[model samples]
Structures are given as C-alpha cells and as structure tokens.
Target: MNIGGRALLNGIMFQSENYTVKARYDKEGNIFITEEQTPTILDNKFVSFMSSLPFLRGIVALFRILWSVRKIFIISFILVIPFTLLLQNYKVINDSNINELTIGVQYLYIVLIIIIFWGINRKYGKFHGAEHKVINTFKRYGKVELASAIKTTRISSRCGTNLVFIVVVLKLISLISGVNSPLVNLSIWLVAYEIFELQETKLAFLSKPFITIGEFLQKLLTTSEPTVYELKPAVEGINHLIKLERTNN
Candidate 1:
C-alpha cells in the first residue's frame, strides 16, 4: 500500500498489516525487492502490534500509529472526557451534566497526545515527508521523479492524519444525538473511504478539512523535509512498481 517506499532509504523495511516490502538499489542498477507478511489484526491491537515491532520504521508503521489504533480512538486522548461527557450530558444518552472540568480535561489530553505524536515524528519524519511526496507524484503522473517529488507537497488526501481529523469531526456530530460509540466510528470510516478514494471528484471540496488538517500535521508532526538521496530511492522504487505492475498485467 505504501507505493512511496520507493523513496525510502535502504536499511528500513516498510510493513503494514496487509503487506511488507523493502526496496533497494544495487551497484548494477538492479532494483532488488523483498517482502514479508504482517500478522493479522486478530493477533494484536493494530496500533499496539505495529508499535511493538522495533523492526518497522517510517511509513511502514504509519497505519499502526498511536492515533491509528481502534477507529475513534485516533483522537482517544482528546475526546476521552468529551466522549463520556457528550454521552452523559443528554437525557436520552444518559443523565448528567457537561462541566468546565470536562472541557479542561479535553485540552489537557490534547497537549499530552500532541507531545507523544511529536516525539514519534522526531524519529521518522524525514522518511514520512519523502513518502508523501512520492505518493503525490505517483498519483499525479503514474510515475515519480526526484525533482518533481521534491517540489510536491507532503500533504495528501489519503493521509492518516487527515483521516483522524475527519474522525474527530464525525465524532463531534455524534455528540448532538449523544451517540458516543465506537460503532459510529466504524461507519465513519466507510464514508471516509469513499471521500478519500474519490477525493478528486466533488469529494474534493467536502474533504477540504481533512486535507487542511493533513497539511498542518505534515508540518507539525508527521513529516520533515527530505534530502536528495532520500528522494532518489523513492523515485526508483515507484518506477520499479510501475514497471512491475505493467509486467504483471
């Protein structure tokens, strides 16, 4: 799924639960590709399993990020009290009151989670940025170039950060009816998938907030500027994928 692994460095391996591959360049101009299968979601909590493995770095562990665990929990920290408060505040959902204490807890939780995510970014952000550029370039032209990739934005409509932002928005809507539940989060993802998959169509304007949040997170937490060498691998890797896909078809 990480087509951008083409831009990554040689030592790192890209692995998500679905598929894993390592792309490397040799002195003879050959592209050597290696792959592995990750464990099932049933094996462990998705994010915990992803984070538990020291073998994965960069975008490989992206989907398994702390914010990407179980659906709505992506903003689990920020909405912890908010969720409970939202459900408890209304008569139908429950019988309780929303107070200043709940609001304060939400802000405190936000700061705490931001610190955690920012710390993770400090380690793998360069590759994260490279991944985004390669993905954008490949999506736009069906190929990737180091130069064009370097000029591309680190933000993408398909970014996990954007998905998280959208989830937060949807969760807010659920508060009106006091349906604070994970099942709502699951349904949100189904709709979100269409939004992301069809983002270039009318979904583009509808998904603007996701793109905006993605850009902000790219700047603040998920990505760092990439170097020429980093960009080179991505270009090569993506070109390899293009060639391989052509051959397979």
Candidate 2:
C-alpha cells in the first residue's frame, strides 16, 4: 500500500486509497484522530481515462491532488488578486508587459505559499518530520512503529518539495529564455512530473540535483527532527490508514 500524508498545524494527516485520517493535538495537548472517505476525481470515467495516459496522467494526478486542497487554492487566489492589484497601482508591475506581470504574480504566489508553510513549520515542523519518517519506515520496513520511524530519515524523494523545486527550476529556465506561454507552462508541468517519477527508477541519478535541492529545502525550511510526542500521532494516523486499507482489501 502506498501511503501519503501532509503535516498539519499540530499533527499529521495520512491518506490511503480508501481512507483519509487525521491525528491532531488540541490546545490541551490531547491527541485526537478523525477519519473521512478519500475524495478523488479519478473515480470519474473521463479523469480515469486521462490518468491512463503518460504525460497527461501526470497533469491529471496533479489536478486530483490539487482538487483535494481546492479550498486553500481558492483562498490563495483571493489573496493574490488584491495584492496584485496593489502592486499594479504602486507601479511595481507594468500592465503593458503582460508576461512580466504574470511571472511576477507567479513568483508572488510562490512566495505566499512558502511564507504560509514557514509559519506552519514554526510549530508543525516536528510533525512534518514525523510524517515523512513514518512513511519512510512503512515503505522501507513494512512497519510504522515509532522506533523504526525514528530511525528513518525525514527526507523523502516522493515529497511535494521535490516537485516544487522542479517547477521553480523550469520556471527559471523559461524566464531566462524569455519564453512564457500557456504551452510552455503545460510542458513545464509535464516535464517536472516526469522528472519526479524518474527519481524512483534506475535513471534516478539524472534527477539527483533537483532531489538534492528539495532535500536541502526540506531540512532548512520544512522539517525538524521529531520527538516521540510528534511521532506518536503520525504513527497512529498511518497505522489507522493501514488498518483501513487492509479491511477494505
């Protein structure tokens, strides 16, 4: 079973093919677990068809993941528009250079996301580390115990951080080459996703630079070494997800 998860403000969320589980600590330091059915667009015939394609499947999978967090994107969009208008009014962005404006806003959006994650990391980094550790333990040893998880590294090659790095690198290349179009954007994502997948194969060496950058970002900005307190909730979340997957099978 492939397990994936994200770190929450005070805990972690783990999801399998059938279940999404969240284990969090309240203000009183009490841990609580919640379960929900996984919501996925891949259930649709059209989406499933698209997911069967190669390059297209990467975009489809991306959309499915993004759809799960649509609310956050909506909120970010709302915030971005006003700030963009503010920049325009201040002459920070010239409307005549649409490409420049678009790229500027894209950078701003990336910055906004990073800032938000930085804030989350202030209190949640340990949980983030625990989340990666637990997943690593499960994948490597088929176990999710705290001892095994603690022994695993927090850095994960399958992390969204690597994808982010690839996107940023491609964007940088586009900017340098003065090529910014819808087609280029689409190609960037497709290529990035392909590179992401390549990291797991024999040609993984080719993606080592991007993966290294992602690991550096994870260590510097995203995750902190977790203690038993943080690992416990992460372990519980994944174990619950494993149990659900087993029962369903």
Candidate 3:
C-alpha cells in the first residue's frame, strides 16, 4: 500500500494505494477508484445519529482529523499526554531497559530483528517507494492527468512524520507523568491514534481531486446525451476522435 505524504505536509492532497484496490481515469477528466471499503464506524446509524443533530458529528470528525497531525497539543493532551504524564508520575522508563545485554550475541539478535522489521515494512507498507513515485506524479500534474490520475500513490506528508512526533510527545508525557510502564502509555496512544487514522482517510478521499474527477465522469456518462443534431459537424469531429480511441484500444 502507498499513502501520500504531500497531502499531510502541504495540505495539497492525500494519496494512497492498496493491492486490493484500484483507481483509474477516463476521458473527459474523470477519476474512478475501486474496492472502496468504508469502516463500520462510519455506518448509516452513526451518520444518521450525527445528522439528527447539527454540527455534532461534523465537529467530531473534524477534530479527529486534526488530532491525526499529533501537533495539535489539545488533541494530544486529550488522547495521549495524560497517559504519558501518568507514566512519568510513576517513574516509568520509556527507554528500553534491555540495553544490559552483556552477551554480544543477544544484542546482535535484537539489532537483526529491528533491521528485519524495518526492511519488511519499507518493502511492503505505506512508506514504500511506490508511494513516493505516485506523489511525484501527482505533483507534476496541475491536479490533472491524461490516462488515469488514479495511479497508485502512497506518499503522505502528514501521517508518518506527524505520527512519529505524536509518539515522541506521548513518550515524553509518560516520562513526565512518572509512569513506570512506558509501553503501556505508548499502547494507549497507538489505540487513540488509530481512530484518528480512519477519520483522516475519509477526509483525504473527500478532498482528493482524482477521485472527484472520476466520480463526476461516472455521473456524466450515465446521464443521457443531449440532442446535438444542430451541431453535426462537431459531432462528426468527436466521432472521429472516438473512433481513433477505439482503434488505439
């Protein structure tokens, strides 16, 4: 899977890809995405409940996206900082205590495991090279593309770096809280951040241009063609182009 970095950093766009999903663009500047999967949390019941009251659900979703940045101190405080503080108050050691591996073999094994996991994630996960290529492609277009703007893109300007910063802050909060269990504090933050992740994805899709284009094109094609007998000459030209497209195909 590829996730966009540019959207997170510059607030220009958000891009992502999954092997199970696909996106494509058609003529007339439309983009289409396949394998869309909406989480159950965003079901009709939740949306309807929120819609029953004005601004409540909208406000909640908006705040969730902001919290994903992890830089929003208020969100961090509500979700993460308190746990960190609790850890600090309990004298939790956030740093790994396994540094005392006097055996060179044991230390080497730990290092190897870290390297292996890093390699695996880099090769297959959201931070892979494919995402970078997609982001670069999107940047090249002025929010437009010829073939399919929905090229698999995983580049994210916001999620990774901001999430790391959030984790670091949470760790510090745990230290400040005097919590003896840094791992526990980290776990709490991770769970809270997962909620933020889902919300961010929804917002990203809504703001995505390629997706918008695809949807618009789908609607356009589905609608009936208006009578154009008066413009037969233009129609002939369009037919020629369409024939060319078919021939090329």
Candidate 4:
C-alpha cells in the first residue's frame, strides 16, 4: 500500500474487490494505506434513502459526526472520577523512588500517544467529502496544499482534545506510581498536566514545518494522480422540462 512514502510488504501495488493498497516510506519508517475504490453496499443504500429526504440526510450526517466522537467521550467519562481522586491524593516522592516514577511516567506517555493516534485517525476518517478534496488538491497542485487541506478537513479538532489527552496521561501516571498522599499526587498531576498542555500548544504551533516536510516526501513516493471521472448522462427526455427552460432562457 502507499504509506507515508514507501512501498510495503512484497513491494507491490495490489487491489482487492473494495480497496486499493499501496506503500511508501520515509527516513523514520514505512506506511501502507488502503484506499476505498467503490461505494459500499451501505453507502449505496444510505444515498438512496437520503435522496428521498435531503433534510433527513443532514440530520444523519450530524449524528454520524457525534457517533465518531463517542470514543473520546467514553474515555472522559471513565477517567474523570479517578482523575479527581488522584489529584486529591498527590505526593512528591524522594530520589530513591525516582526510577519507578519515571517508569510510570513513561507508561503514561505511551498510553497518551496511543490515545492521540486513535482520536486523530478516527476523526480524520469521518471527513468524507473533505478527504476527497484533500486527495484531489494534492494531485492537481503537486504538493502545494497538503497542510491546508488537512486543516480544512479537520472539523472536530480545536486543541482541547490534545490537552485532554495530556491531562489523562498525568492522572494515569499518578495512579501507576502509587504515590503516598492523595492530595499531593493530585497537586503534582495537575501541575504537570498544565505544563504538558502548554508544551502541546507550542508543538501545535510548529506543526506546519512537519506538514511541509511530509508533503514533500509524500509527493516523491506517490504515483497515482487523482483523476476526475465523468458521470454518465441519464436517459434522454428524463429532464425534458429542465432542457426546455435552458433552451428558452
């Protein structure tokens, strides 16, 4: 599949009944992407149904967006109570326990990374029309609009989720370390969480540099250019009234 910028697995392009796959690589690593080729059975059915009711389709689209964010909501609910308690019981450990503390922090870091990946991918997938625009713009422009496309299509993100992930990680570390004094641990966690949030914001500000580099690498590896397919005309006389108006006007 075409991954970040390298070929993957047998180093061949392949297509399945429903999807086309390609691979690519960069200095850091490789990535394989499976892109859907055809509308699914569900997509066909939904389009047919929505065609009969345009207003209802809008409602469905909104609901689908909410459904996509359900995971983030669930995680918040699961951790809120524990996080509060962890803050209440926070304590500072001595140098002797620093190693264990570091380990706990590391584990939390891993979990936060996983959470960020999951959240971003999940939200990114739901940008149906936006994804098409991104692919098309990238193909036509020759690597000029990748970051703008990504930012335009990313509708749900607002910097809050990143902060939330960092806060959750701090709470998780406190829970893992089993530190004495709930209040002390809680205080430490809150302080660290705030600092992490600041760091994330600073990192976010620097995102454009990374996007530019990635787009350059991506263009190097990409072989397929987005093509516009013509739609077949419906049976003649199907829209005779519209045709008449066009002729007269």
Judged by lDDT, which candidate is best? 2
Question: Where does model 1 exceed 4 Å of error?
Answer: 1-20, 24-33, 36-113, 172-177
Location of the lowest summed lDDT over 10 successive residues in candidate 3: 222-231
Clash count per candidate: 3, 0, 35, 26
| Per-candidate RMSD, Å | 10.2, 2.6, 17.8, 16.1
Q: How close is candidate 3 to the true structure, as a TM-score?
A: 0.30
92-177 per-residue lDDT for model 4 (tens digits): 54567656765666567667665654554343323222333343333445332434444332221212233344445556666566
lDDT, candidate 4, equals 0.38
Q: Write the per-residue lDDT of candidate 3 for residues 192-226, one digit (tens) a residue.
A: 34433543476664334433443342222211121
Show model 3 residue runs off by greater than 4 Å. Answer: 1-34, 43-117, 125-127, 135-155, 180-249
lDDT computed for candidate 1: 0.58
- Which one wins on TM-score? 2
lDDT tens per residue, model 2, 155-245:
9888888888898889878877888888998899999988888877899998999999999988988888999999999998899889888
Superposition error at 190 for model 1 (Å): 2.9
For candidate 1, the TM-score is 0.57
TM-score of each: 0.57, 0.87, 0.30, 0.24
Candidate 2 runs further than 4 Å off: 44-49, 79-95, 109-117
